[model samples]
Target: MDVFDHDAGGISGRRPLVEIEEGAGFPDGLTVDAEGCVWVALWDGGAVRRYTPAGELDRVVTLPTPRTTACAFGGPGLTDLYVTTARTGLASPHPLSGSLLVVPGAGKGLPQPAFEG
Candidate 1:
């Protein structure tokens, strides 16, 4: 996966600031924290990885299910990390597969901005 920097003109010309190898499992979804760290959900890897703004791996949180799909921060002060998983391809589903997990005190996250159309 790659994160890019757009030029002043537009997205027509841009360069990727971070390029992660495909061997690192598919990145399904991600969210940026208040500290500018990125939390990424790994599908088929059963884990979520936190990456620093410099593209360095900071931390990893593993889940019981391999099909972890998405994640977000919620609850009071956005100090909780909520993860979502899937059981679509599991031969023997894990007890928590396809469930919503609330991990308290994961880290502080920035509140999502409301769309202004």
Candidate 2:
């Protein structure tokens, strides 16, 4: 993803943060950890990848099914990775397709901000 300069409506200073190969599936859902690292789900790649703030590949977590759609942190400590999958458009879906797969001890999530409006 590209990081845009946070000035003038973020219309300038666009820079590449990371690049994923076309053959390595598309980058789908993404979230930032409390430590400022990025967690990205690879759609049709059957895996999740973590990258450091400096755009370095830090970790990879493979799933039983492809079509990984989205991810988020949950559980008591916010360290559990809740991954959502999709079975749409598949002739024969995997057993775990369209399931909420949770990976324990994935990472800590940012504290949720309150909004009342």
Candidate 3:
């Protein structure tokens, strides 16, 4: 995927970021942590990957289902990673598919900043 810098003039430029391998599932949703690392949900890959700001893969958290769609940090300390998954188009039923999963102590997430615009 490409990361763009937004400015008064609109998107200033694009920088090539993480590229998923051919067989890896598509990236569905993502969130950036307070430390500036990116947590990405891998659709059909059954995992979440944490990448450094420089687009380097740092860690991976595997899930029971292969249809993980999105993730976000919640909980009192914002250190819980809540993930969402899908069950549509699955040839067989998956126990965890279409369920919400939470991983505690994943990492602290930054509060979404307010936009003046």
Candidate 4:
């Protein structure tokens, strides 16, 4: 994936920021944490990975159900992870397929900033 220079008020350019390993499943939903680390959901891989801002793989959270489609941080303290999965094409899906899973104490999420636009 790449991060682009967008502070100029236009689509300036982009530079490589990270590379997902081969066979690590297609990169799906992702969000930046409070620490600027990236949390990505891996489709067909049954896992969520956390990468440092420098693009280094730092942590992985595995799930019993495959086809993880998206993830986000939620909960009162914002230290919980809410994961979404899919079971549309699976011949036999896990019991938790398509259910929302919560990972407690994952990490703090970036606070939403007020839009000035």
TM-score winner: 3
Question: Model 1: per-residue lDDT, tens digit, 1-117?
Answer: 466666777654345545556766688888889999899899888898899988888998988888878989999999999999999978999999999988899999888878999
Worst 10 residues of 2 by lDDT: 2-11
Across 1-117, the per-residue lDDT of candidate 4 in tens digits comes to 787777657876778878877888888999889999999999988999999988898999999989999999989878999999999899999999999999999999976766999
TM, every model: 0.85, 0.90, 0.91, 0.90
User: Candidate 1: where is the Cα deviation over 4 Å?
Assistant: 7-9, 12-24, 115-117
How many collisions between residues are there in candidate 4? 0
Q: Answer with 2 or 3, whichever has the higher TM-score.
A: 3
lDDT tens readout by residue for model 3, 1-117: 679899787996798889989777889999999999889999989999999989999989999999999999999889999999999999995888999999999999878767999
What's model 1's overall lDDT?
0.86
Question: Model 2 over residues 1-117: C-alpha lDDT tens digits?
Answer: 777668656577789989997877789998899999889999999989999989999999999888998888989989999999999888889999999999999999876777977
lDDT of 2 at 68: 91
Candidate structures ordered by lDDT, highest first? 3, 4, 2, 1
| Residue 30, candidate 2: alpha-carbon lDDT | 86
